[model samples]
Target chain A: MTQQHKHIISMLVEDEPGVMTRISGLFARRGFNIDTITVGKTQTPKVSKIVITVKGDDRTVEQIEKQVNKLVDVFKTIEMKDDESVTRELCLVKVSLSNEKAKTDIMHYAQVYKAPIVDITPKSAIIQLVGKPQKNDAFLELMKPYGIKDISRTGTTAIQRGGNGEK
Target chain B: MKGSEAIVKTLIGSGVHTTFGFPGGAVIPLFDEFLRFEGKIKNILVRHEQGAAHAADGYARASGKPGICIATSGPGATNLVTGIMTAYMDSSPIIAFGGQVSMSLIGNDAFQEADMMGITLPITKHSFQIKKANDVVPTILKAFRISAEGRPGPVYIDLPKDCQVGEVTKEAPKKVDIPSFKPVYRGNINQIKKAADMILAAERPVVIAGGGTIIANAAKEVTVLMDTFMIPTATTIMGKGIIPEDHPLAIGQVGMHGRKAANYAVINADLVMAVGCRFSDRITGNTSSYAEKAKVIHIDIDAAEIGKNIEVDVPIVGDSKSVLSDLIVVMNEKLKKKTETEWSKRMKELNQLCRCNMDSKKEPIEPKKLLFELNRILKTDDIVVTGVGQHQMFATHFIDRMKPRTFITSGGAGTMGFGLPAAMGAKVAVPDTNVFDIDGDGSFLMNIQELATLKEENIKVIPVVFNNSYLGMVRQWLEIYYSKRYSQVKLGRHSDFVKIAEAFGLGGIRVEKPAKIQDALKESIRSKETMVLDVYVEPESNILPMLPPGGHLKEAFGGCMNAKGVFF
Candidate 1:
């Protein structure tokens, strides 16, 4: 049987207009679904680091790498194994407070998860959390009772573990 | 200097002399620039954007350059989707331009606005949206380079009205600086040696030449290898004219509707050397058993296609000519002469045994006889373009295309209405050569209005419509797959192509019997002005040696009987 597993891929791409569209379009056209994605400025101003998590069989993953490399703006691509990578996701949620008891409960959950309450009001409270994707999901699920107004989650960004693991 | 001027200058810089386009509001400034440098670059004004796209594709395929086309926003840009996809599927290098809505009105649903860059992203090798006038020259140079570089395909540039009209003080750039794109051209010496070793050892070997052989201009290299090793070959639809089909060792096409000898040669072979060919499902029926007996040697420029479909024993990722040239050099020293003498003799015997009888004397005219005469009447260099159907398969089967870029067809997309316009485009590219569109009755009606373009432009192209009164290919499927219940396949004798051609102020003729087929073809050829011969043929005759659905090439069917000795 073929092995289907989640792969963490990173790329240094040209920070130009339509670069995102070109990269995303390649995956979409080939039917590779992106589980999570994050884009950020790299050490070099003109290059951006794009981290993408996707699920595919071994052959499909290999083809995905080749297809992604075919794009002109993409400089280099590195595949990071799930066990040998540093991964994190950040989420911010604005929840409505019905009473003082609700604020106390929200703070208790935040402390347990090492999340910080960024803002507070008589009718609402804003809490910020950072962890793995599953941790953020747990925080959001626990915040449901406090009447969550809105939630914003940054997709997981991954990096190779340890020194000299760069490609 | 205006941005549009920069764009035109870049076109001239890239050695482009001809382009096809239709002007609209968004591209007015670019059109003005085209007119300003009118003599330097020739732009053919087409009736529709799709025509421009297809004509440019034909010109590109004929002349070995990236074909160019321009269209306006919204409907104009959308209309080119078919042509763009056709080029994409067949791996043709075509540089297309779409005039987008201004930067301010990109997503505001402004008049004549369309997301061309987004729509064409999947179809193009690279797509760029020009935000600044200064970037026009660089973008165009990149577009030209990217389109023709590795695994050649269409590239698009979405030039907004604002960018076209914007002014740039600096001159157009001379060199492109896209650091990320580098195409691999040379094959590894070790892999070359391994392939040469296999070629030297194999007793029964057949070579499968594909479209990439033509794109890489590697016909001479392939021919050298064939002559030196005595390997018989079969081609796909797009690879028809890569090498002369009349060569003694050629077994014609392979796969569905392919020559029976070609399929037999491959299925019975011990080694299959596929050069620059993607073993698509259309070519390799039942991928699991496509080449079960052969240890495959696959050479292509695209690494993605190496083992994408059929499994390969040796996968070499490089240009076709380079790899084949390297193989030839190594084989000369590593191998003995006349290695495939017995295999080659058997190939010839099988070819003669399975050759379809094309000399039928039946009434209402058989397709094989007509295609054979058409093949005999045309010049070796005269180009043949085709739309999709049984006629397409017949043309590929019978016509002996002796020159590269002489047989143009929509092989990948199987698009109808590609024949006439593509013929006109080829004629425009090479004025001295005669162009013929071997079109089917159903495929001909899709863009018959292009007859007006032919008459107005005085383009000397012959439209030989094989009027079988049905969608012959689809009807064949219905006959084989279903119980002969052909729905929507018959076109119940309503439209008169001869009268339609005359209405467009062109010459026309109708041939109903077998006796008139040759004379009708000759008459169309002799007349200088554009003409059409509405030749009616037998509706039941199907292309021979067709692979049944979900079957291997060994189990291919011919004349209602399976080549594997089974009758269905």
Candidate 2:
């Protein structure tokens, strides 16, 4: 059987066109499916940081990390499974509140969860919640009894908690 | 100026003529601006934000243009995530503009404030938050370019309320200056040469084409290679119609529920030239055993997909059309056609055997027969879209897509409700062309709400529902491996789809008899508005030629055997 392991990869690269294409293309050529990828600008101008989460064996991930780092625009690439990282996700949920009683009940739950009421209409109220994915999920389950209508969640984003920010 | 006015102007400047959205508190100002610019930019007020997202997706898929959708902060924005993920999976270009809390209150737990950027990061190709109104124009331009460029997917832009209301004294940048965004279009010569050499040396070679080929418009180049080398080609679900199904080199689709001949050829081949395909698990059943004897040469535009699932012996990264062209050039220079008459003969025999096994009875309305009849009625230029599940597999198996863009289905995501809206978009894209959405009863209801959108747009699309009254795919699994637990697969609740269509002010027809299918379809096609033909199918019917999950492609069960061990 093929060995499978979860890998978290971090990269510092020049922010430009087709870089993502090139990076994703490298993974595609190797037949590597990216489980998750988060890209955002760093504090410095013209630089972006990309965190890619992949599920593969250690050897495969090492090979992928090496190939990715060799790309001209990539400044650095590091596998983050060994590093301390802070992962966060955000979610917004709409709860159906047909009457004032349901609305007030939902507000009380929101207060307990520290979720803010974002939008309120006579029929429904939207709540904004941000935390680890598990926390958001727990909050959503708590609200489910109140008649949740819809949910939107961002998968996951990670940053090194406290380490060499630059590679 | 109000934030709403800035958003409207940015949309107009981005060349968005139509937008789908619902209003909320955070976006009330934007809705007000939408009213002011009602004539300039058509704002569609969908019943739900989810519907708005699907409508935008439909518009984008049909028009080959980026579809735009708007939603307020929190729930309204979150509702668009499903649509966003759907677009992302299918590689459709769409722009989702989400309302955000004011910048000052972004992390203060203010009203209508949700972290839109963080929430949509995984599903979106890229996303941004506007800190000032001046950034809106440039951001819109960048978002459009990113969403529509090579291997197009969905992008998002979150507008904070304060930024939309802020002043913009300077003009937005005419163009973005990201140097790292260039996609590699041309194939590397050495890699192309190595691939060509391998193909030339192999006695039995099969080509697995995927959605990337269609996206890259590489069909012509693929045809040249197949014809020159007499290589048998099979397609992924997304790759249907990239080559005419009737072409001699075409061996049909491969993987779970794929054609037996196609799977056999892949397993027996000395070399597998996988072009523009990701080798999704649906196509490769058992990862360790798949193509065990073959040298796998995987070529794709997206480098990340190359060895993620299946390892490759030789990898080439570039646009499918360009890479195939270069490979062809090298092959023409260094190689001669190597004939494998015995292998070809065996393949033909297997194909015949599989077809014979799948051939169903003429009476009591066979699903395959329906597909054949639909194929017979369709013009070569007509477009066909399918909802996910058994019906989707059946359509991909039987339909003859002779032209490019003739077959449109949600392949990657396999989103259930994608058929109707996508068909609507296809019709809107090619107004003169006929488009049909072949759907399952279970899948159809997921987006049946879009029936109203079709009526409002006045777009004509023929919807043929295979009313099996169950989730046929799941039911098939339960029957084969799960002891027929049934679970929630049965559609016990009554839903008169015909009546539902009528409720939406569209044409409706119900076909109980096999003989009525043609007439019902013809009438629906002739109708000017959206039409639904709810055809009752066999309740216990299962899609045949099944390769059980994790089973070798070669180990296919011909069909469901009766109690007497007789194949259906």
Candidate 3:
């Protein structure tokens, strides 16, 4: 356990009932503390893409890879480097703004981050942000002093850059 | 076909010739259907559910096939925990079934309903709860495959009452292809080549043969590695019979209470070849200091065990026999000659230093003497099962095995009552072979009721009870670790074991003197019914060559090191 760093593993799996449970159950059993995970149907009708981010050293990453590969539904698993992959996360934030000037300021910050205000009220506004995880982090940092009401985050999901490993 | 009928048919298809279990309400339907296929598959009724699990385990270990055991829901299922755990730890392939309540009444807490899968999850290699009758046969086939394939272990399946009460179409079972569970059988040639080079370079190379060797049937390959290199070999308790103990290169048991020569050789070795044996804490006490001087080449079927406990220089993950064969080929091709170093000659002498003289004819019969005499009667392939205690250690030190799978004991879990049922199961598996359960007085009583099972089943297993009047192993631990202030270790001399045997309708002999040991043993072995030989041993005598808890390899003290119970 040396050099702790976030590891992103993208997997291609057979999309079926209980397949998600098997994959997640495997990671859970290995004691691999998952930081984030996103699962959805892939372009192939029967296949699904599951991207999981975990913080661990090299050995833990290797162990997780071996264990995940052992799952029956998993067809392929590959470790994704930050530079080699395009990662994204979506966050919906509801901000509390009492006055018109506060609302204008919150909208100004949201616009700077290119986040769209999807819902609004005199007391609160819901700003939807989409980009890398860090972009959402920046938007939250900007909105903290504006009295934030609530937030829901879509965990970091990734796809390897270019046409490589698309199957 | 009814679900119960499908299960029986699937079991027959899977080559399950025997099953050990007890009948209960939840399993009544299955039992009724099971009786119809009686000659096709024999179900031995055990005294308790736990006994059934252990018997199944014992059968699996001895027969080299998956053993089956069935039990009712709730209590019956939970009872198999100890037995299933014992099998799990020892890598025995056993498929256990737990009858569940109807699928509708599962959560209603109806009569005899239990979450069998949840209880057995941690202990089993895998657990399944079948929901539909159509899935019963496929699930059964998968259970068999999972239990016997790769690194064998127990697999539990919960059969709901509803699934067993239905009529469904009979169809061919699907192929078992859990791709993720693929076991690596062939060794990586590059790694094998690297390991061969490491072995060739070392002056003092010691091969530690573990249970994996037996599990993979790799003794012939292990011997090839040992004999070709003249490398001194040591065996874990579980690996006792990898080769005949009398073989020149064999260094007997290694670890706490293991052979002194073996402990010395390992500590002094330049290179260690750990084959199929996990360097368990008991095998490698104070892991840091153990084999610290050696460059280790660890070979095993399990990838997780490679560097889990001890760091290895070269880790080869594959079946032991396959790896050993690949290693032997690589070594034979690369090496010009068998490198006979002076270290080889020293190993032979060191091996002799570990040998103990058990000729003492003291008042109370010595367990060592009993083991020595017993060894004489036990032929090459005779099976010996022992309950966990000082008797187990003594058996490890003295019981000689010329063949594999002949020595059975609860190695991983060290469950006390494993001996009787295990030996019973082993005898049942190989009916013609003489199976003996060498147990301590304290350990024997743990499952003494199994005597009735043996008597009624007509299973011939000689139970040699080492009546020391105390939990001998715990007492020894007290002596070494607690300044001999023995607490809760003694079992006072009140019970008569032979009389108990007679009550069970089995004959028994009580031997108090050393000369009568042979007479008692022969008489018990020749008895028409299941017999017990209560051989009284000196209570104070402790098993020697014990490495203290967290002690270094060469730091072992007690008997075997010197003639008069000398401590080093």
iRMSD in angstroms, per model? 1.1, 7.7, 3.5
CAPRI tier for the interface of model 2:
incorrect
lDDT of 3 by residue, A1-167 (tens): 37989999998887765567666767776688888999999988888889999999887887788667655467788998898899999899998897888888998988888889999877899999999988898889888888888999989889888877667
Docking class of 3: acceptable
- The regions of model 3 sitting more than 4 angstroms off are A9-32, A37-52, A67-77, A98-101, A131-135, A163-167, B336-339, B563-568
Report every candidate's CA lDDT: 0.85, 0.80, 0.85
Runs of candidate 1 exceeding 4 Å displacement? A91-152, A162-167, B559-568
DockQ of each: 0.67, 0.06, 0.31
Task: List, residue by residue over B205-287, the lDDT tens digit for candidate 2.
Answer: 88999878887888898887666677888888888878877766687889997877788888889999998888888899999
Which wins on DockQ, candidate 1 or candidate 2? 1
Scoring the B chain of model 2 against the true B chain gives a TM-score of 0.92
Q: Which CAPRI tier for candidate 1?
A: medium
Clashing pairs in 1: none
- State which candidate has the highest TM-score: 3
DockQ of 2: 0.06
Residue B334 accuracy (lDDT) in model 1: 70
